[model samples]
Target: MGCTGPLAELGGGETVRRAMDVNFLGMLRLVRAVTPSMAERRSGCVVNVGSVVGTAATPWAGVYCASKAAIHAATDALRLELAPFGVHVVKVVPGRVKSGIGRANTAQIAGGHGGKPREWGMYREFTAAIEERARASQGAGATEASALARHVAERVMRPRPPREIVYGSLTALFAVLAASPVWARDAFFARRFGLNRKL
Candidate 1:
């Protein structure tokens, strides 16, 4: 449900559309299928897993960030909408839990280059940075998947589950950045993602 590439590249629109379809629409489809039965029973919980990137935009992974942001916004709306039906909707914003997503994304990006990484014409100089961004979430400091699962399960099982669960590494930092002024946030990310220099 993620893609890594410069938004200015050719065919970027298709990339964004694909990310949205898979990440956002895919969730919507599942929610639609289950919400009806839950509404009828007047009891059920829907847990949506979002990401820290959704809170603050980052370079290279704009499509992924946008899709997650859609999830976050939709989850918020669904919470209020489903409240009347006794169906609880929880938004889980995970920072970086250990997963194979990084490798998978890397492979996808490299698939068109004869099993090697491919760089867009205009972004050739930024290839390494782009690859780094693709693997950023799989760092050693990332949260353990099992731990995140346990925490989420315990909380969701509570009689009164929280409306949102923000967990994992960099979640707090991303939350703060999300609240910061646009200019400041932009400066921080620009420097962090190697966008501070002119190409």
Candidate 2:
């Protein structure tokens, strides 16, 4: 529900701050507030559900990706830092989720696409179709949050647990790409977004 649309001309510093506050700082503040209690117990687990955007910065969604990327990095470090104290930090990253949240965010961005009133006129056809396609594409299940909860629960009970764990198809695919060379990963997403420049 708190996603952005591109039409807000939301490119200024204030907009950036608003996004960072909600997407990055909001989670961070929550964790910070909770950490003291977790530390006091000397045994706690924190699982942060992030997005593929966090891992892979997508075009036209730079701010979203940036926030996500920060979370990923923070989670990774926090996982290690928390380990010795019996606190576990796990990050679950998913992709292309047919979520109302995703739809809302995409629509938000699409609404702001052209950047200005005059620019909107130019972007009408493209933005309308993008919105339509976005609406049409939601509702498939690429991930199961309940299953993710089970996995996290299992991790919590384990005497020895992983520092970081990803969930579902997006995580799996990203892992495959990660193991491969950079060029291959580049080709993969390039093909996906039709951004491959084969001139």
Candidate 3:
């Protein structure tokens, strides 16, 4: 299952919870719905589309990143659980594929659906950064959705699909970030997202 929602400020627990529900729990539900049949048949392939951001949390989109991280972890667990049943689980990590997510996220932010970042207690000055993060995928270098879909389709159809697939723009960047030390990663993201700015 591949899907994504907007980037929103986690002003209260509700926003975070909602993001988790959509990104992580939604995948859980889909898996639950199909696992019984797949188990019975002793054959099936479950493909989960995650994000490179999930590999390492970034400044403005922490909640979204957390949700994707949960997917990665859960996908790993599910792969092991379904192995005995001859089920294959694949995790697709896309960095930034061209899609409507950017527009949707921008609209959500504009509609103040997640929260008013400008009104946030500690994150007020960084709202612009948050907005930028939400819309970052729409940049020129984003991978085409059709291309990503084709690549994933071919991989999943293989006799033994890869447990994890990383593709798209910024995948390499996120890979470097994922391999970096926590302190270094945090510092880089903070500076990039303007969290280090003194307003």
Candidate 4:
């Protein structure tokens, strides 16, 4: 299951709820609706498409990252629970596979203000940077969707599917960040997102 949107410019309640609905709850609803049949059949593969940011909270996109992180955790639990039923739960963590998510995110954020900048409490000056961060994954060196699809397809078809699959641009960098100390991660993201500097 794949889903996403921009939440950096939205208020706390709206941002968190929107991200949770799309990134985490949507998958839960899908599994709830479909898992019974799969369990009955005693064979199935569920592939969840998450993001590298889910592994580590990045500045400016905390809501979206939180939702993805929930998916990562849920997927782990799902993998364990479904194994005995011959159901394979695969978590595909994509760093930045080329897609229209960036455009959609930009559109979603802009829709709230007719494509004009809206008042962003406390983060007023960093609006552009936040927008850039939303589209950052689509920049140069992003992995093509076809390649990611092929890789996932090949893996899921195996006798023993991987519990977690990580790929796409900046996958390694983000993985390292996810494994780093909290202080290091905070410092890195603060600097990268201009949070450490005065706007």
Top TM-score hit: 1
Top of the candidates by lDDT: 1
TM-score of 3: 0.88
Q: Give the 10-residue window scoring lowest on summed lDDT in candidate 3.
A: 1-10
Q: In model 2, which runs have C-alpha deviations exceeding 4 angstroms?
A: 1-15, 110-141, 157-159, 197-199
Expressed as tens digits, the lDDT of each residue in 1-199 for candidate 4 is 2223234445466556766897799999999988889999999989987889889877767777788889999999999999899999999998888988788667655654466634567777777877777787789999999999998899989988998899888999998998999999999988887778855
**Each prediction's Cα lDDT score?**
0.90, 0.63, 0.81, 0.80
lDDT of 3: 0.81
TM per candidate: 0.94, 0.71, 0.88, 0.89
lDDT against true structure, model 1: 0.90
The lDDT-based order of candidates, best leading, equals 1, 3, 4, 2
> Model 1: how large is the Cα RMSD against the reference?
1.7
lDDT of 2 by residue, 102-199 (tens): 55655455444655322234334345433443343244655565676687678756766666666665666666765778788778765654446543
Residue range 1-199, candidate 1, lDDT tens digits:
7788887783556657778899999999999999999999999999999899998989989888888999999999999999999999999999999998898778868874466556689888888888889899999899999999999999999988999999998898998999999999999988988989996
Sliding window of 10 residues with minimal summed lDDT for model 2 = 116-125
The pairs that clash in candidate 1 are none
Model 3, 103-191: lDDT tens digits are: 77666566556665234445566667767877877899999999999999999999999999998999999999999999899899878
- TM-score for predicted model 1 compared with the true structure: 0.94
Better of 1 and 2 by lDDT: 1
